[model samples]
Target chain A: MKSFGVNLLIAVIWLLLSAEPSVIAFAMGFLLGFVLLAVFQRVLGSRDYMRRVFALGRFLLVFAWEFLAANANVVWVVLFRSKESLHPNFITYDVTGLKPFEVLLLSYCISLTPGSTTVQVTDDFRTLVLHTLDADNPSAVRARLDRVLKRSILSFTR
Target chain B: MTMTEMLTGMLVLSGSLLILASAIGVLRLPDVLCRSHAVAKALTLGIFLMLLGLWVYQGEKQTALKILLAIFFQVVTIPVGSHLIGLLALQKDIPRWRHRPIDDYREPGNRS
Candidate 1:
């Protein structure tokens, strides 16, 4: 398969970078090399490697911070609050500006952001339906996610 | 122990604890949809920290780059898988808690 050749090529490159010249290093590189290909098949599509690298850095920093905050928010909700304190509701997200791939990635980002899970994306991909644990301020949630999280994800698609 | 080792240990410990918290969340949360929320968050954070820790410990360019790649893939996949599972829960007519104010599963245009 084509993936196999790509895998081998990465493994060779790995060996070159590490320069350890040991069997263990090569083996690890081969294994990890395959994984990089498998994992980043989408990311690898971009020919603009230089621009993408910077975008990737920004995306990672933003997501990492959001990820940690989401973890904390969910932990608190589950551990400290009783059912009475929780509010679960659905909200539809506007997906007009984003591409198909960006929309798909957006759902994932939304779900991982503590209080929300995307239940459905419309057939046309024009609308995304999300369920939030705390929907007290649906508009605020929508604005923030749209601006800070989902909008940033658009760069990855380009 | 070296500074890198200490940092790696801390990272791994925190990552494991996040995962442990996710497991508890699955049990404590009332419904599958809510549980999905907890699982998605915890899984992303947990795996990322663990991989980052391993990269720090390894201190090799190739291995570290691959680990970073793994984390990116894992993060991207978790939300999607969880989203599908949550969709299934909705399809099954999983009962919502009393606090649930809306059900847009029919169509957002239709409010019940």
Candidate 2:
């Protein structure tokens, strides 16, 4: 019963996020999605469902902070620096998280920042090749990213 | 021309210029991933500029709100698009240029 309720909420969230549905479409789509969810629910089981949502919430909070900082730094660099000050380089940094989804999210967080972009993510998912406008402070930057990722991962998974 | 019309024309011109610059950068960049970055970042800015220009040109609250929505959508979409394309390239085994020894995402057996 608890599993079904969560499944129903997930389906409804999916529907709301995806499209604007007419009353008929909404009811039909929710019914179809709910039925499919029930099958997957039995197969997958409700292992760490709450953990996933909590992890996402943590990621969002940390991401917001990083985003604000990156944007401000970018604007400052653009406004003050001449073309000569720019040093565009691609740097790969080690990411500590284990899960595929977690690694992917970290890569994304790095890429979404203004100065840094993820050019590649390795298959083993341990490393991330990031392009940065200024690669001068690579160590500091990598350490900073490592700390933030650790906080987000630990905050929810623990 | 009225001041409003002149302002509108300038905004449109600037936004169009940004869009053209991004398009050219995407085509001219040496690598696929780099080109994606150029397109993702510049095109987003271009769209924002154009939408804001349109908002200013219309000088209506509703159009301005719509323009804000457009910008919001672009902001959310561009990074996701870039990540998807990058992941796809990795899946396809695209070679990345390494200018120096750095380890953002590089490890033995983890090369994508």
Candidate 3:
């Protein structure tokens, strides 16, 4: 598969860059190479993402912004908000037709954001249960997930 | 220490603060699910910052690559682990310590 080639390229690059040559180094390179490849799966997919490298860059930029902003949001809530003020609640969002990996990756992305943590996927795997630090405005949370998070992930899956 | 070293130290310090925030959430937050919020977000970012600071201090491309690998694995595992823990906590059906009106998951049309 093309993913394996990406891994091989990473390994070769690692071998070329290293000063010492050893089997351990090679093995480490191979392993790390696989990790790198998996991390870029969204960008290097066989069908949908192969030609959307620019889109991938855009996604990363947005993710970086979200990560920084979300961290700040969480930092404020955690450091300043009283326990009584906390509006923690559970949400069940229907994924409907997303691939298994898509659901998993989306959950990971959601978890990394400040206010949200994925609780569990449903028995049929079509629904994902989530918990949030704030759920007073359910529409806002749903908007972010659908308009931003879920849409961005669609490029990887579809 | 050099400026780079100073910066690295600052980064690591900030990372520790985030970790502390997650710890406070664990101890002070009313329930397992709520606390998992801290573990999933703050803790992951904290570990990432520490690793990134170390990567910068190393200042070698190869070292940076290795650090990235470590970070990648950490990022991959943390959410999966957190999700499972949250599921277990849900299965145990432990009521939150506060027990307020926050059970939105039971709302109709929320689940499709």
Candidate 4:
């Protein structure tokens, strides 16, 4: 957080120093700040900032792909698929080892993607109750969540 | 129209079509949970693409920045809002669709 704050500070200083106060200028400044931080990591004592930023970038790319796929899935279900085939049901997802924030993020990501919406979390936070639109293959859903969402989230956070 | 303008128009049109599809899903889906799924995912993506089209059309740095911020907040908030609605419906013991066979959360042994 401190490193991020310093990076933002550097970007803002660059923005102020530059003649054109445009978004490109700000972005350029931010990139410059990122490079500087990377170069002076040992001197600055902020080692993990670059790794976190890269993780964040990867997470964003994965999320964007998921978001597009989600929209496409919804469109298919809504337009082409028959209503009777959809077996909407609440399934339990084991969130045994996730931190509270990671669980929250997982639920939000679940809700945002594909056919799942997290309805409730157990008091112990060990399980999440998710309402899936198409439960014809519940195991498939679980596998996809584990492979795409949970993996990306763990990589970004841990 | 220029290439950028053509691209913007196509994006906006597709976004509108997606939003329309979401509305149709809301009407056609069996229950609240299913309907909310449509609203949360499709509608959010539609709005995002539309804003992206607008950002492309404007082609200004400040406008781009503001639209990016708007998109961020929209993506963050919409899911939370829909999740709360789902939670409330569950709390009210709203009936699930007749065909739904599994409800692991409400099973006697599963309640925490």
True contacts kept of each: 0.64, 0.28, 0.64, 0.78
Pull out the clashing pairs in model 2. A92-B103, A92-B104, A92-B105, A93-B103, A93-B104, A93-B105, A127-B105, A128-B104, A128-B105
Point out where model 1 deviates above 4 Å: A1-56, A155-158, B61-70, B99-112
Model 2, span B25-110: residue lDDT tens: 55555455655665556565567667777877777554566777887898768877877786676567566444455445444583
Model 4, position B9, has a per-residue lDDT of 97
TM-score of each: 0.73, 0.51, 0.77, 0.89
lDDT of 3 by residue, B13-74 (tens): 99999999888878777778877777777888889999989988988666678898999999
**TM-scores computed on chain B for all candidates:** 0.86, 0.76, 0.82, 0.86
- Across residues A14-129, which tens digit of lDDT does each residue of candidate 2 receive? 66775664444456656665556545755656445545555768788877777656545544543455545565566778764568776766776677555677877776677777
lDDT of each: 0.79, 0.65, 0.77, 0.85
* Clashes, model 1: 0
Q: Give the 10-residue window scoring lowest on summed lDDT in candidate 3 chain B.
A: B103-112
| Backbone clashes in model 3, listed as residue pairs | none
- Per-residue lDDT tens digits of candidate 3, residues A34-59? 66655676676633334344456666
Computed on C-alphas against the true complex, the DockQ of each candidate is 0.46, 0.21, 0.50, 0.68
- By DockQ, the better pick of 1 and 3 is 3
Runs off by more than 4 Å, candidate 3? A1-50, B61-65, B97-112
- Pick out the ten consecutive residues of candidate 2 chain A with the lowest summed lDDT: A71-80
Please count the clashing residue pairs in each candidate, in the order shown.
0, 9, 0, 0
Q: How well is each residue in B56-101 modelled by candidate 4, as lDDT tens digits?
A: 9888865687988998898788888888889888779788785445
Off by over 4 Å in 4: B61-65, B99-103, B106-112
Ranking by TM-score: 4, 3, 1, 2
Better of 1 and 4 by lDDT: 4
